[model samples]
Target: MAQLGSDLDATRAWSKARWRSELRAARRGVPASVRFAEAMALSNQLTSGRIVRPGQTLCGYVPVGSEPGSAQMLDDVADFGVRVLLPVVAGRGPLDWAWYAGPDSLRPGPYGLLEPIGERLSTTALRIADLVLVPALGVDRTGVRLGQGAGHYDQSLPLTAPGTPLVAVIRDQELVPELPAEPHDVRVTAVITPHRGLIRFD
Candidate 1:
């Protein structure tokens, strides 16, 4: 984790909030066609990159609202015969998981999230995932992900087995040179963007 002073920490927090607003606005402003194109591009990149083998388990989430992804992206990944688990927001604690049967299998979850309507599994399910694709407003080159202040992923990601590829799915512009960081924050090992495909951090 990057060291920081008290004043620097405060500044970074404020900066994160500002960046969140700016990025949200930018996403909202994107044309529907452009968003769809980008989403499909992301799906193709994942499928073609062979990030997860056919038998590997993958943990992914359904992109909701202006989240910079489409339901088709998750569906396409699952089509590879890989077991895809969707996040279940059981409470404020670590996120649970349920098998992604299909898009129709999803129901409205808390905070407008789309969760699977199947047998729910615990966070330990994450330990088996060969790859984890998490949502992010932005990600720095150093792998520090700028997430929603909720800290759900930050807390839950620690349960994963060491060296699991935790990838943050974001737009090309969302990849930055630097961002705010804290000691407790769990950094992403890689980032996948529409055009850039996957960029891994050492």
Candidate 2:
């Protein structure tokens, strides 16, 4: 188990480095507007089947640093009556979340991440969320997720209810056949991609 943990961390670090380089290259190659549009479409399709309904909390990510344009995706989801909650880097232990009222509610924070400018809404408060869209650099068809090596999402995912759906957001090509996984590495139930839409592992 120790060996597996060490190996997973090592592979995670390597994968993160490679993904950063690849993302930079992809940005240079792909049109910014096109990527944004495709991503928006993918997100919309993913949430379409699920009934967000008014008052349902949807845990989401803030589009900061190298994370994808999920901030915009949250906005669209919010418009659909889902109360969006964005993660705040509260500490190194696990991810804490805050309510995202709008663009004005966010402020730049550590590592360029944006968080709630006002009092943070405790992640525990949003425990009844119907859905949660996780941010990931890559994910495999079998639900193996590759995060940014910080393990924030990995640590926070397990806190959700036994059957809460965790969906990873990645590019179409980022969904691979397999990726290095650790016992602690949380796998998302489904993946949302620009061209492919929602892909369920089961």
Q: Report, for every candidate in turn, its global Cα lDDT versus the true structure.
A: 0.84, 0.71
Ten-residue stretch with the least lDDT total in model 1: 1-10
What is the TM-score of each predicted model, taking all chains together? 0.91, 0.81
Task: Please identify model 1 stretches exceeding 4 Å from their true place.
Answer: 1-14
The CA lDDT at 165 in model 2 is 81
Writing each residue's lDDT as its tens digit, candidate 2 over 1-202 gives 1221224454444554665455445545656777678767766774685535556877877765445565676777777778887778877767777778898898887767888765665656446667888877778668988776777777788888778888887777677665767799888999877777778889
Best by TM-score: 1
lDDT of 1 by residue, 24-56 (tens): 777788899998999998988888846777788
Question: How many pairs of residues collide in each model?
Answer: 0, 0
